[model samples]
Target: MWTVGHSTHPLEDFVALVRAHGVHHIADVRKMPRSRRHPQFNVDTLPAELGSAGIGYTHFAGLGGLRREQPDSVNRAWKNPSFRAYADYMQTAMFAAELDRLIALGAREPVAVMCAEAVWWRCHRALIADALVARGEPVLHIHTPQRAEPHVLREFARVENGRVTYPGEPELF
Candidate 1:
C-alpha cells in the first residue's frame, strides 16, 4: 500500500504519478474531500478524472483527520494538538473499521491512501501508515513520480496488542 498527497500538484501530474506507481484505487482520507484552492482535487471532479485514467476513487471519511483531542488523552508524545487528537481517534472502532476497509481494498488491488498535504510526515497519513505497519502491512510514501519512501514507524510510537499509542514522559514528583 502507498500514501500520496495532492500537495498542489496539477491534476494531470497527480494522475500521472498514481498511474506511474500502478495504483488502481485511491482512498481519499481527507476530512473534507473538496479543495477550494485546487478544484481539480475536489470530490466532484477527482473521481471522473481518475476514472478517465482507469483509476478508482473512494472517500473514507471515517479515516479522515481534523479530530479533537480528548481532555485526558494518553497519546501525549505527539506535541502537536492535531496529531494528538488524531492519535486518540485511532483508538476508536470507527478508525479500525475504516482502516480494515482500506487494507481489504489493498489486498485486492494496488491502493494508495491520499490526503492534501504534500509530505506524509506532516499529514495524518503518517499516523495511518503507523497503524498499517502495526497490522503487518508495509506502506510507502509517494513523494513524486520518480521518488517514493518506505514508511518507518514513528520513533516515539508504542504498540501494544496491535494498537499504537504515544505516551509522554511520566510525572516526576
Candidate 2:
C-alpha cells in the first residue's frame, strides 16, 4: 500500500502523481474530507476528479485522524496527543475491520491512502504506517510524482502478534 498527501498539488498534477505510482484506488483518510484552502480535494469534487482519470476514490471516514486521547491512554510513547489518540483508536475492532478491507482492496490492485499533510511523519499517516507495518503490509510514502520512500516502523513502536502499541515508562518524578 502507498500513502500520498495532496500538498497543494493541482488536480491535474495529483492525477498524474498517482498514475505515476500505478495507484488504481485512493482511500481518503481525512476526518473532514474537505479543504477550504484546496477545494479540489473536497469530497464533493475529489471523487469525480479521480474517476475521470480512471482511478477510484473511497472515503474511509472511520479511518480518518483527529482522534481524542483517552484519559488513560496506553500510548505514552507518542508525545503528541492527537497521534496518541489515533494509535489508541488503531487498537479498536472498527479500525481493524476497515484496515482489513483496505488491505484486501490493495491486494487486488495498487492502493494509496490519501491525506492532506505533505509530510508523512508530521501527520497521523505515520501512525497508520506503523499499524500497516505491524500487519505485514509494505507501505510507501509518495514524496513527489516521481519519488517515494519506503515506510519504516517507528523505533518506539512495540509490535507483537500483528498488533502495535506505543509504550513509555511512567514518569519517576
Candidate 3:
C-alpha cells in the first residue's frame, strides 16, 4: 500500500504518479472531497477521471483528517495541534474500522491513500502510515512519478502490542 499527496500537481501528473506506483485504486482520505482551488480533483470529477485512466477511486471520508483534539491529548510528541488531534482520533474504534476497509482494498489491489498535503509527514496520512506500520503493513510514500520511499514510523512513535502512540517523554527502553 502507499500514500500520495495531491499537492498542486496537474491532473495528469497526479495520474502519472499513481500509475507509476502501480496503484490500481485510490482511497481519497480528504475530509472534504472538494478542492475549490483544484476542482479537477473533486469527488464529482476524480472518480471518473481516474476511471478513464483505468484506475479506481473511492472517497473514504472515515479516514479523513480535521479531527478535534482531545482536551487531554496523549499524543504530546506532536507539537502541531492538528497532528496531535489526528493522533488522538487514531485511538478510536471508528478509525480502526475504516482503516480495516482500506487494508482490505489493498489486499485486493494496490491502493494509495490520498490527501491534499504535498508531503505525508505534514498530513494525517503519516499517522495512518504509523498505524499500518504497527500492524506490520508496508507503506511507501510516493514522492514523484518516479520516486517512492518506504515509510519509517515516526521516531517518537511507540508501538506497544500493536498500538501506535506518540508520548512527549522519550522512551525509557
Candidate 4:
C-alpha cells in the first residue's frame, strides 16, 4: 500500500503519478473531496476521470482528517494541534474499522491512499502511515512520477499491542 497527494496537479499528471506506483485502486482519504483550486479533483468528476484510466477510486470518509481534538488527548508529541487531534481519532473504533477496510482492499489490489497535501509529512497520511506500519504493512509515500519513499515510523511514535501513540514526553516515547 502507498499514499499520494494530488497537490493541485493536472488530472493527467495525477493519474500518471499513481500509475507509476502500480496503484490500481485509490482510496481517497479527504474529509471533503472537493477542490475549489483544482476542480478536476472534485468528487463529482474524479471517479469518472480515474475510471477512464483503469484506476479505481473509493472515498473513505471514515479515515478522513480534520477531526476535533479530544481535550484530554495525550498525543502531545505533535505540537501541531491538527496532528494531535488526528492521533486521538486513530483510537476510535470507527478508525479501526475504516483502516481494516483499507487493508482488505489492499489485499485484493495495489492501493494508494490519497489526500490534498503535496507532502506526506504535512498531511494526516503521516499518522495513517504510522498505523499501517505498526500493523506491519509496507507504506510508501509517492513524491513524483518517478520517485517514492517508503514511510518510516516517526521518531516519537510508540507501538504497543498493534496500536501507535505519540506521547510527546521524551522519557516515555
Candidate 5:
C-alpha cells in the first residue's frame, strides 16, 4: 500500500503521480474532503477527475482526521493536539472498521491513502501507516512521481495485537 498527500498539486499532477505509482484506487482520508483553497480537489469533483485518468476514488470519512482529544488521553506521547486526538480516535470501532475496509481494498488493488498534508510524518496518515505496519502490511510514502519512501513507524508508537497507541508517563510537577 502507498500514501500520498494531494498537497496543493494541480489535479493533473496529482493524477499523474498516483498513476506513476501504479495506484488503481485512492482512499481519501481527509475529514473534510473539500478544499476551499484548491477547488479542484473538492470532494464533488475529485472522483470524476481521477476516473477520467483511470483511477478510482473512495472517501473514507471514518478514517479521516480532525478528531477531538479526550481530556484523559492515553496517547500522550503525541505532543500535537491534532495528532493525539487522531491517535485516540484510532482506538474506536469506527476506525477499525474503516481500516479493515481499506486493507481489503488494498489486498485487491494497488491502493494509495490520500490526504491534504504534504508529508506523511506530519499527517494522521502516518498513524494509519503504523496500524497497517502492525498488521504486517508494507507501506510506502509517495513523495513524488519518482521518489517514494518506505514507512517507518514512529518511535513513540506502541503496537499491541494489531492496534497502535502512543503512551507516556505523565510528568511530575
Candidate 6:
C-alpha cells in the first residue's frame, strides 16, 4: 500500500513520481476528487491521463476524508478536529468496506491511495495508514520518486477489533 499527495506537482511530475514506485493503480481518496489548483487531477481528466501511462485509476469516495466528528468522539489524542473526526469515522462499516477494498487491491496490484496534501503526517492519510497498519498491511508514504518512507503507526493509537482508536490513558495524561 502507498499514500501520495497530488501536491502542486505538474501532471508529468506526478506521473513520474508514481511510475518511479512502479505504481499500477492510483486510488483517489478525495471526497470530491476535483482540484481547482490543479485541474489536471480532476476526476474526468485524471483517469484518462493515468490510463495513457498504463496506470489504473479508481476513486474510493468511501475512504475519502473531511468527515465530521461525532458529538461523543473517543479519539481525544488528535488535537485537530478533522483528524479526530476521521479517526472516529475509521470505526464505521463504510470505512471498513473501503479499507477492505484497498487491501484487496493492494494484494492484486501496486495500489497507492492519494489525496491533495503533500505531506503524510499532516494529511488524514496518516490515520488511514494507521488503520491499514493495524490490519497488517505495510504502508509506504510517497513524497517524491526517491522519497517514499515506510509508515510508522502514531504512538498514541491502539488497534481494537481491527479498528484504530487514539484514547490515551486518562490516568497517564
Clash count, one per candidate: 0, 0, 0, 0, 0, 0
Per-residue lDDT over 1-173 for candidate 2, one digit per residue giving the tens place of the 0 to 100 score? 99999889999998899899999999999989999999999999999989989999999988899888887778898888889899999989988988888888899999999999999988888888888899999999999878999999988899998989998877568
After superposition, candidate 6 runs with Cα above 4 Å error: 169-173
Residue 84 shift from truth in candidate 5, angstroms: 0.5
lDDT by residue (38-155, candidate 4, tens digit) is 9999999999999999999999999999999998887878899999999999999999999999999999999999999999999999999999999999999999878899999988
1-173 per-residue lDDT for model 6 (tens digits): 89999999998999999999989999999999998989999997999999998999999999989999998888988889999999899979999999999999999999989999999898888999999999999999998799899999888998887789998645444
Clashing pairs in 5: none
- What is the alpha-carbon lDDT of model 6 when measured against the actual structure? 0.92
Tens-digit lDDT track for model 3 on 49-84? 899999999889888999999987789899899998
Rank order (by lDDT, best first): 4, 1, 5, 6, 3, 2
lDDT for each candidate structure: 0.93, 0.91, 0.91, 0.94, 0.93, 0.92
Clashing pairs in 3: none
The digit string of per-residue lDDT tens for model 1 on 35-88 reads 988999999989999999899999999999999999889898999999999999
Q: RMSDs, each prediction?
A: 1.1, 0.9, 2.7, 2.2, 1.0, 1.8
TM-score of each: 0.97, 0.97, 0.95, 0.96, 0.97, 0.96
Worst 10 residues of 1 by lDDT: 164-173
Error of 6 at 162 (Å): 1.8
